[model samples]
Target: MNSMDVVRVLARYRFSYTNEISLQDQIEAVFKYNQIPYKREHRLSDSDIVDFYIDGVAIEIKIKGHPVAVYQQCVRYGSHDSVKEVLLVSAKNFALPDVIGSKPAYVYFLSAL
Candidate 1:
């Protein structure tokens, strides 16, 4: 599925815990329940790792952080050859732009639903 499709699927996911690890686990469960193919904790390089990678989308989960740092990280992930888009699942709404670099960027806040 595309990044937006993946986001829609994840948007329906319900979470009882808000911790980063728990959120990751719930996300993995959602992907499995929907039969979505993905790689958890995908390593892009020695220092750069994404929370989940599906098709050409790289998803990152953050419970708390400076918005700028998170966006930069997602942009770095987008720079990777395998990633065509970036998705951030964050606890707080960062109001990120529609695109980061040449690839599309999306964010879903856990606090919303």
Candidate 2:
């Protein structure tokens, strides 16, 4: 799947209203359910580790706090050479940022559905 398609698939996933599955696990489960291939922490260096890199996109799940920090995190991840897009998946909606430097960026609200 492509970047946008992966976003769509992940956007459709509704986490069970329970404590068993974590946000991170839910994300991975959704990706697996859709049969989309991904690599965790496709490292840029020793410290910069994006949560999930799929189809030339960086998907960072931010379930709490303000969107600005998450958006900035997306920007940082988008700067990587292999990343063509960045998906900032959050619990609340926020204004999407324009293309950061060169890579296209998108925001997907996980709770929108």
Among all candidates shown, the one with the greatest TM-score: 1
How far residue 80's Cα lies from its native spot in candidate 2, in Å, is 1.1
Write the residue-wise lDDT of candidate 2 on 37-83 in tens digits.
Answer: 88876785576788888878887766675767766777778778888
> Which pairs of residues collide in model 1?
none
lDDT string, candidate 1, 13-57, tens digits: 667675789889988999999999999999998988999999988
TM-score of each: 0.92, 0.82
lDDT of 2 at 57: 82
Worst 10 residues of 2 by lDDT: 12-21
lDDT (CA) per prediction: 0.86, 0.72
Q: Write out the backbone clash pairs for model 2.
A: none
lDDT agreement of model 2 with the native: 0.72
**In model 1, what is the error at residue 26, expressed in angstroms?**
0.6
**RMSD, every candidate, angstroms:** 1.4, 2.6
